[model samples]
Target: MEKEIDFEKHLKNAIQEERKLQVSFFDLVSKFEKKISNFDFENNSILISDYFYSGNGQKNIMKSLISENKVNKENCREYSTKEGNLKYDFKGVYFFLLDNKPFYVGISKGVIGRICQHLKGKNHNTSSLAYKLGLLRYEYLNNKKHLGKRKELNFVTEVEPVKQFLQKQKIAWISIDNDEELYLFEIYCSMKFKTILNSFETH
Candidate 1:
């Protein structure tokens, strides 16, 4: 008979990998903060930078807002139980960079989960990164003309390619403890960065 897969072992390994990634990303955040010493900031803003894909070129820098919860051993304990979890919730507002530009700003309580969804092209709603990129590609092909049947077909076919292109894009984020502040910060970043992937209008 075939051997059974040890799902519990797999989950433990995955969590460990995720924790390592977060720790490294946080270190990158610190370096970016020091690099941008000259920029003025709002009350909660913090700066972070990193390459979109691992083994890529130079990192991109962007601003983020600080959250009430700080990442420490007490709060951000790594996998230590059978449950195998990261102690701190990976909650935050995150930005997606395309061609070293801020393309989207979003808030997520499960930061990695949300980013994975975008990378996998798992969401298809209007606000989804995949959907928006598909729309951008469709528009580029049409050059702002009315949607036609062939154009619609073309758009549908291009979604995968768009996702593939974006899968390697880099990201930077900061935690926001409160949901209200998270949304507000997302809006603030969207406006400040003039991010193209944001659908909601904000002043």
Candidate 2:
């Protein structure tokens, strides 16, 4: 009986401490909310439509952005891959907007590289949103739901329209070097903006 009472006391103290921490965390979140509210995403935004296509055909979106001086070369870091050396922008949260409203919100250490993956990558790991969009298209066209693995989706044909759709959208980002705040701000932006493509589900 005495031990039970002691446990209850400890639990009460812990809950009180947790509540205090929540208050402190929420105060910080309030500051972030104000910062996000004041952020000018319009003039600062980079439009993908201008860089989506070249004289030949659809071009590499990242390379076009870099070539036209839309993305800051000084902030990009290059690394070698089997294909060739590629550059990625510094850490930040990025937003994909359609009609000037946020549709997706994402975070990455390499913001530009991650966006490239979404626009150009062929597989689910590299182009998840495109894959989902393609899957939806497949279902809509076939009038049947896909029950197999996402990898089985026909990227060459199905994802082409999805990539085209993404190319017509606009992108904007804010640099957040701190990982904790970066993650929290992503969720906050997704909620505040009511982004449709963001999923908080754990894999």
Please provide TM-scores, in order, for all candidate models, with all chains considered together.
0.51, 0.72
Clashing pairs in 2: none
lDDT of each: 0.52, 0.76
lDDT tens readout by residue for model 1, 40-99: 233223222222233332111111111332232232212332356443235677677655
TM-score of 1: 0.51
Which stretch of 10 consecutive residues in model 2 shows the poorest summed lDDT? 51-60
**lDDT: which candidate is best?**
2
Q: What is the C-alpha lDDT profile of model 2 across 59-172, one tens digit per residue? A: 355566668766666666655555775555567889888877788899987787677778867678799878878888999999998788877788888876888888888888
Stretches off by above 4 angstroms in model 1 are 1-89, 144-156, 201-203
Going through the candidates in the order shown, the clash numbers are: 1, 0
Off by over 4 Å in 2: 1-24, 52-88
Q: What residue pairs clash in candidate 1, if any at all?
A: 52-170
